[model samples]
Target chain A: MDKFSLFVPNFLPCREYFDPGNNNACPGCGLALGVRHVYKAADKAMEKALWENISDTKFFGIKTNPSLLKIKQKKNELIICLDNEAGGSLRDALKKQMPGMAVAEGFKYVATACPSYPFDLYDKVKKALDTEGKSYIHILCPCPEGWQFDPENSVKAGFSAVETLAFPLYEAVCGFYTLTVKTAKPKKLSDYITIQGRFSGVTDSEIAEAGAIVDKEYSKLLEKIQSSYSYTFETTGKVY
Target chain B: MEASSGFLKKMIKCSLIEEGTAKPYKSGAHRKSLPEWDRDRCIKCGVCYIYCPDAAVYRLDDGFFDVENQKCKGCGICHSECWFGVISMVEER
Candidate 1:
């Protein structure tokens, strides 16, 4: 892990993932952009962690230890070797899975989003992909069609979301909680919703009530961030 | 040569696409605008490349960035992200 410091932010992976096909997502689609960003972050995480937890199998030659990447508490007596890459079973020989060799849980990833919070988005995703447990990064992606906002203003929508405390950027890792983005002066919830047609029907009083709810949520989150309290297993989601 | 009558040749019945390929030419057509890059203003920060959803902005061997016009959806994300104002989104005529 100490090798991580050698990584300079200027040094980004130019290697492209094998994109099987072009996406048919609508232009200015927030979901598409979110997926694209997540893909990039995960690719960079894999490329950066290229040197971590690598072992060899008798047949598979050189391969990453799946258990190390996965945070399962079970201790399997798996033999590891540096030279096993020399004769391991072809990993994708059938390019499929076998039911008999399955883990109790299927593969899953933590999910999260917003474009205004790109730095926050990238950081959280990279952490999620690199970390021990199932971590999720929640991004506030604005849809033009659904939100009734102009496509050009999609990015602005994201900005307004964070600015208004409609969505607070955060990450919870190893029972340690932290707010990634702290809005010094949160804008009005009305400001967050005024642009979107979906919220056009919302009355000012109702908006105020929502703002009160946001304030309560934000303060509770702030408490978590301030206290160095390490929560036990019950505080977080099930990781099995 | 034709196979012998008693012999059976097996082949995949489904279409198989070669992996790890990108087709920028197709989506490049439906775009409404294109990004223009200013070489002088660029700091080579790789920010443009990072923010572009299509991965159209690529860094060159000389450490400068350029766009793959066909693949770019002209979303203007690169234009918006460039700190040096090196990228400008120009409407397609």
Candidate 2:
């Protein structure tokens, strides 16, 4: 009936599809919201494919950390690396271990940080999954309890993370980097860190240091995207 | 006529409550703010009712959308999802 209704068509009749009425999730739980967006997007994407063609296609769901050691390691057609900040480090480790997995093999590796940028993240993930080879999607879901913030501020924190460049929204398809939610003027790191109780004790110098890291990484992403011939051609259509 | 002291005592006694009987425990009490309906602004599209995580938003008998406060956790999903920007979260006094 409604546009939002289309996102959860099959699950709406159950009444507790996403929230599941009687759960113990605290009020303003951002993780719950993140999970809902991610799951709905993935499920809806899969459903569309199933509806179009039941035969000649198969979908398998695999839940694992980026650390290959945690699960029985095997090459998957699509590897969705859903993580918080801690999980991002693990993803980095996996990438370091297998440098050629994404670029040389042309595996779709999408690394994103927040659900507040849902459309960009979801659409990229779906596109990556649709491709032939292995794909990895990294999502950063902030925890209110663990991060020491009021549950209601979860969405705000998520938004702040992106705006402040603490979690730059981007996707790396076949080792090519592209910034998704490109803010015209990014906010300072303090704007993001001040909200979360976990960073309450962080000093001014520490914030600056973290800001430097974000800036460096962002510049590197820009350079990587700029140098790539495909990205250049895709954007300006005049390849060097 | 008031009840007798003996009957009052029996009524006060604690008993084993049924499992899962505490479903939908007055989440409205936890809300810091509640979504206020703007009838004039609302297009009666029912987007609020459909996207509400708690399913607290409902259509009234006259076909206007309203919130059942008892069920609303004030997640603000409706406020965010409303394309018309009709729903606004007002702080509870």
Candidate 3:
């Protein structure tokens, strides 16, 4: 109601909302956790910056990666598109990742399950703020009351939600899709639902069916993310 | 007619609130478990800052992280998510 965008790149507002543990909320009630986690959702003063320098010789540069730098600087950086124009392969590979000289080409969509862990949520928000179009942040808010777990388990639930592949974290820009977070081992769907209180009555067959569905959706996401950029160098008439 | 006129008058007389003057929220009471941050063990990973629902964890000027006593509701998220074991949840007596 108050136009609150609580750094949506950050984790769920599940446990921070109600805080049943302290506020005379019902014992074993998880609604409190959701409320408690979000208590300061609107408080900007509390934003804990994860890093000292978010940019390369600049302050508050959200999209600092080589891919996004092109868009930020309004410059057409040379891509290692052609093999002949490029130097020896081994030397090029090392310097390519060294910054400033990296290839900033194509559309990238990053899907990471755990926000602010391997990635910086502040940078993500800054990037969204700097961008000119309508952007959407999708957060999976679990109701401990409905999920039927200990209030403290909300964070665990979020981690497992990503690991189980039940809920995939992805960001799509324009038409490009990227899965930022990749789980080493995808757990079973039942493993995710078993901890929640509402899914207790689900049978094994139903879980198996749902498992197949999750796998299907995961593959579909990967397919979209794998979509590549095709470009031809005019001088060499080479397609890359 | 009178009510409508009054509403218009109020809108015209409205004053703007200053920005960045918000007070810290005092919500420490009623918390079941409080997070005790070990300043020495902290790796400054900012993990507590990210997972904290209430945004209670603050990054101090010296690169050290600390919790605001007034704003914390004892959610324990910071404690659970901290990889360095810097924050431990102690029950409120």
Candidate 4:
């Protein structure tokens, strides 16, 4: 049974899982954007690592596992990649369960408005990974498909979202989390809403209300990063 | 084709706005009380004729653009492209 708790997982991330013609029409679904972004990020990371260590490391093909539970035998490095859905929460529970594995949670990896992982939840997972000497990179990919926008507007929406603090762009290293791009104050939520079709139902007044929610959330996240504390490394030197 | 000296109007479909709303001819700028048609001022350059995307402008045998005002979407393609700036897009409101 799929456990549903604090985290939500986009279990079906593969294009093959999608039927050519389905009865359910999810035109502005953000989950699809999250899957595509994760796949792209994985490819880029592997390529960068390979180029950096051409002589020392060999390129190996990756197999997609339903659950990323396999322990690295000799390399002593285990990477767990998950979306910001129930599956990600399950992974977080597993991290609490297994002390030997390191977990990295992706945030806003796909949708401009909908972040992959809850920003607060991501903070905790990122804290755990850093203490283990593991690297955590949060990807924020905006999707015009998810936003119900003209497909061409994806890149513009993506940039605006970051600048507006509708989505925060930053990296967490070790125990320190810093905002790479800072906005003095969150921009009007309408600036983020009118461009996309998913939020087309949103009115000018409702837009103001939604903006308040976004601003409150962004403020809380900023406060958390500003006052971050050092986290204890949980996993033993089983692999390291 | 049967040629008429009077205005022959047609409607175009645009998903962006309300359907079946008959907009006046390019809407009502081509009617009289607008301006004098100076044939000498016009070079018969065919700029307006070639520039209208909707084919709303046609050159008559008399060496002038016969603009089908009702058929024009007011897209301003002709007005902007005209080297002589003879064509203008008036406000619909």
Candidate 5:
């Protein structure tokens, strides 16, 4: 079938696939935007692979959340893990559990957020999937309700999270780490927290403490990437 | 009794609803603000109609665009997408 024909079917209103108009997601939900970008990116990547005569592949989406622990049904529960809570990162946890799959950190650039960043990151993800068989993209999808922000400010809050260095933008492809979008000067953590209602009553000392944690984590990531370069090149047989 | 059971099974089979037929529950009650259109400045380009995710933007018979407040979730997508800047999201009283 023609590419357009395939694309048209996916766009058609279906309960299975993510439809634009009928989604139950809250207004300005970052997860909705993130999911949409992933689908669009995967579609383009699949089309490119088809044109190149590569092996046909299927896409499977899995949403991992620790909140599923409250559910009783097996079908309703997928993966139970604390993602961004209690000093635990989901990408690291997944890496430890499944040593074989490539874990990548997908992030949006403040300069080119939304449409541009998602598409760019998708291409990187598609490449990783083709080479490594499986890839996990840890996207930072902000919650307006939980974060206590107006729905209209979801995009702004998402951007702020990255700018504050609370969520660094990097990709870990086959154990190799690469910072996708580098910030010349990251914004203060307070700038991000003050806008959200959840952090409305937070004190300056608390903000400083959180900022310190982010800085420490970011430095650790940089050190890990630097130390892993030689090993990554040895194993992958290609310099990243 | 056997004939009644057979008829009940047939009715159950026929009662399955068609996919995509169920209308979404009204979401306008969730809106904190509503988009108001200024007809004097509207060029009727229909950009708002195309970009509305909730399908709240409707074109009147006279080529003027109107938002169905009952369906609008006050996402401000139409306000952002309007090229002529004729649409403004005003606080809903």
Candidate 6:
């Protein structure tokens, strides 16, 4: 299959974050390993989506964040948008390199690897990208390996992330927003912390602090869902 | 003919079962061949546990070491952790 058929734009692949020599990693950082897994999974997903239609797929990279521009429709093409939390400055740097090119006029969809935490900020970013109609936005989160948690607790972390607001699972199209909520309760962060080495030094009080932040964030998400129309998304899988 | 059969019996006595748990020798001079465990010298620090990617040596409820001979690939991590020579890796008798 022609794997890169969607003009797949990549931010930074996860492997870089886990390199032992990177020095940025803590002794027990599970998040680094988790990120590597998720990136591989996401890549597989995108690849599957592209290869399934290889006969007509045309992959491209904008090398710019979707926030900066209104993407003009290109005929018979699937565009992939990518960004990381490292900062928006890198996107600006890319735009500056192409002095005449602006980001606002470029992307149709944006995908984020970061969890949607502190929902207010997530909303502002979503609004910036949804300007040209409803767009595909994804927030992939609660990575067990990344957060220094057990690999199995990822789903629990996912719910905690959304419920506590440390992460929110939602998609926004145009001005419409829908929050994804599963019936399961968020598991204790302690259960998640034991498997990973990163949180080894975190004190109980600090964990409590993290919990409060998550709780506040989740409350906001629930409020948003109750106030807006809800839609269920059933279609998700690796595409290549 | 009697001597040949006796020699065969001795050889059979020395043989190990195909899949039984390997343990320290029950008695006699051959017992010294087993790996030594000096608990007083052990700090119970668990470096042997952490560095053991295979997780061969694990802690027991009574707070002692337990070896899984079947699972152990005979990696020298336990031997390496014994700075005071509490544990040693030895060949099977």
Q: How displaced is residue B17 in candidate 1, in Å?
A: 20
What CA root-mean-square deviation does each model show from the true structure? 14.9, 10.1, 16.9, 20.4, 13.0, 21.3
Off by over 4 Å in 5: A1-17, A44-116, A229-239, B1-23, B26-72, B77-87, B90-93
**Model 1: how far is A46 from its true place, Å?**
7.8
Best-matching candidate per DockQ: 1
What candidate 3 gets wrong by more than 4 Å, as runs, is A1-121, A228-240, B1-25, B60-64
CAPRI category for model 5: incorrect
lDDT string for model 3 (A36-94, tens) is 33232322312421212324433123343221111121221111111111122212211
Query: How much does candidate 6 score in TM-score?
Result: 0.32
Q: Label model 1 with its docking quality class.
A: incorrect
* Chain A TM-score values, per prediction: 0.61, 0.67, 0.51, 0.45, 0.62, 0.39
Error of 4 at A176 (Å): 2.6
CA deviation > 4 Å runs, candidate 6: A1-166, A230-240, B1-93
Better of 2 and 3 by TM-score: 2
lDDT for each candidate structure: 0.55, 0.58, 0.48, 0.39, 0.53, 0.39
What is the per-residue lDDT of model 6 for residues A18-106, given as tens digits with 9 covering 90 to 100? 12222232222223323333333334232323312333333233433322211223221223222212232212211212211212334
Name model 4 segments beyond 4 Å from true: A1-137, A184-186, A229-240, B1-93
Angstrom error at residue A238, model 1: 25
Instruction: Single out the weakest 10-residue window by summed lDDT for candidate 2 chain A.
Output: A65-74
Scored against the native two-chain complex, candidate 2 gets a DockQ of: 0.14
- The best-first sequence of candidates by lDDT reads 2, 1, 5, 3, 4, 6
lDDT of 2 at B45: 66
lDDT of 1 by residue, A73-139 (tens): 2221111111101222222211112111111122123322465555556666665555553343344
Query: How well does chain B match by TM-score in each candidate?
Result: 0.68, 0.71, 0.65, 0.51, 0.71, 0.54
Best candidate, TM-score-wise? 2
iRMS of each prediction = 4.6, 4.9, 8.0, 20.8, 7.3, 18.4
Q: On a 0 to 100 scale, what is the lDDT of residue A221 in model 3?
A: 64
For model 1, residues B22-91, the per-residue Cα lDDT tens digits are 4443556678888888888776777666656566777789988788876777777677656668888888
